[model samples]
Target: MPQTTVNLRSLFLLSPDVIFLNHGSFGACPREVFTEYQRWQLELEINPVEFLGRRSGELLLYARTALGKFLGARPQDLVFISNSTAGVNAIAKSLKLKPGDEVLSTDHEYGACDNTWELVCREQGATYVKAAIPLPFDSVSFCDRVWQKVTPRTRLIFFSHITSATAVPFPAQELCARARAARILTMVDGAHAPGLIDLDLEKLGADFYVGNCHKWLMAPKGSAFLYARESAQPLAQGLVTSWGYSERTALNADQEAYAGRETFERRHQWQGTRDIAAFLAVPAALEFRRKYGWERMRAECRTLAALTQERILAANGLAPVVSGDDILQMLAIPVPRAGAERLQKWLFNERRIEVPVTAFGDMAFVRISVQAYTTQAELDALVSALAEFYKDKGNS
Candidate 1:
């Protein structure tokens, strides 16, 4: 009922004809931020050499400073990447995993990240161990369940701070603290945490962390960051060995003069000439959130997401995978185990509803993301469609 929540819908560029309930997949950028992104692109095209050659380092540093302040990390510890997947690949490939070594993670991880670890472990003869954390998650017992799988050969612990498939928020601080005591390296897939939840990378005690600004923070696409603890920086080299690599010493001294002094930035920041507009416009996204009182908007969206889940679950007669408090703006509601693809297409093609249908184990979920642009009527339409669709098959 907050006026800001209703009015905020107009600020985004998403189509008014469609009910977009999939902000979790890719965040919707505000008009202001998109304009800033374009301005940066224009500046880049105006003089390629001036922007990429002479001024990119300082411009990126300013952008990183803003992002670091937002993430509760130092600029020196963070570097811009395309997305969380890129960050995961960089770290996964960089870790020294011998045969019989293990990388421990939960079953609720993102699919791309899971594949990244699986490939790395496959190549090195290391094992990728997945802890099967049961549904209706209990935060108190979460760490205990994951810790039971740890062994002397366990080299790393990786889990999502907020899981993508199930939309559950894990207790990262407790798990990270436990991993630290056990002398196991910890890497967090925090793709959903940056804006949906508060993050203090320094205090979280994780050796490595990655967050997607393009998801919750409402930044332009291709904007994300990787934060490495000072101790862990040496272990995470760039996935693409570019001019940032130390052995590429022909340009290291000159690169250091302009690319800043930190090895983390030196290694990861410059990965061939690509669009840096998204990275540079991150400050504008932050400014838009601050200007529009996005905290209140996000809180309202959380309440809406919970209500949306309750309505869908009531229609399908299925239990939830996670409690309401465990999710923020995104809610994963269990749908009938019929055809998830059919239901998803039906909703989009027939009802003009935009939402994701995901299958986990034997269950199918309709993951709904309630953002500032979402409306009660839009959600009601989705609920009505689901009830009607399932009723046609006598499943509701």
Candidate 2:
């Protein structure tokens, strides 16, 4: 593969002193996108009524249209939310899971999402079943393992498209197909998948999917979206009951049309008054990627992530949890056993490198994210730090 020739590090607003290898956590937005975000904010401040009350619906429609085009979904089927967890909460709370009903998921889900299901299941007297997927992942057996856990009581299946802790890309399409055959609804957590991978929510056929534009897509913070298939739209209710809840109280002709919008949008779009600059700036983030040929850039980033994983694991003498092809621009490499927090802080404080050390069960791993702005030298810095950390362990 040809390497990216353009220098991209300068386009981001990340600190020059810190080697940022943690893009998977909270993304770093490009300077151009941030400027566009601020422009929207200024416009909102100049006339709050015009921005939020009067013209906000039309403006938001345009933004959602752009995002919908990018994700291959109808604009009416999508609604802007603060984050993926918010989307999960909206759907989880809305579902009327009866007593003895079960919601199936993998063991590799995000912590906050797991908490959402745990609390919801407890309140509703339902069971949340997390099927264990063994390491050294087998794609062939992946769907079977998950399907085997499903019982007649299983009402829904929820899993991440790309897992956060393990950095493995689950076979979401296959799982969705399987769940559909069994008359179970599927909701996909695509938090890290928007810009990192090719997506067509319509073709993927999940009942509901939520993704973060702020993560791999490089949008500003507080930018994310929830997608519902036309048939499933009525099942989703907003976390906050705001103006969009009723079409009878439309503010104006245009506002009324927005208020009488699709059941999905009308419920979730206007969630009280909040900063919508991040959501509106999603188009700018898409433009930035288009101008820079982000497909090739993502390929280069994935190469760097795989290479860094190889370099780090070679020193620690531990095998990788997932195949290189299964992941995109992020990788989780098993490291010498140690406290995850201690390992993370040591890397940040001693090495001036910002990375995440996460533990799954007893194994500890260092999750590295390579973005368009990442370079070989920063990865080299991480590799060197791990080598020193291993040496310190020997000496101790």
Per-residue alpha-carbon lDDT of model 1 for 1-396, expressed as tens digits?
Answer: 346534777889999988999999998999889999999999999998888877888899999999999988999899999999999999999998999999999999999999999999999999999998988778889999999999999999999999888888999999999999999999999998999988899999899999999998999999999999999999998878888765434342337574434488788988888899999999999998888888778888888888888888876778988875686788888898886768888899999998999877888899999887777998899989888888785543
The true-structure Cα RMSD of candidate 1 reads: 2.0
The residue pairs found clashing in candidate 2 are none
Runs in model 1 with CA error above 4 Å? 247-254, 258-262, 394-396
lDDT of each: 0.89, 0.88
Best by TM-score: 2
TM for candidate 1 is: 0.95
Q: What's the number of clashes in each of the models?
A: 0, 0
All candidates' TM-scores? 0.95, 0.96
| Predicted structure 2, TM vs. truth | 0.96
Query: What is candidate 2's local distance difference test score?
Result: 0.88
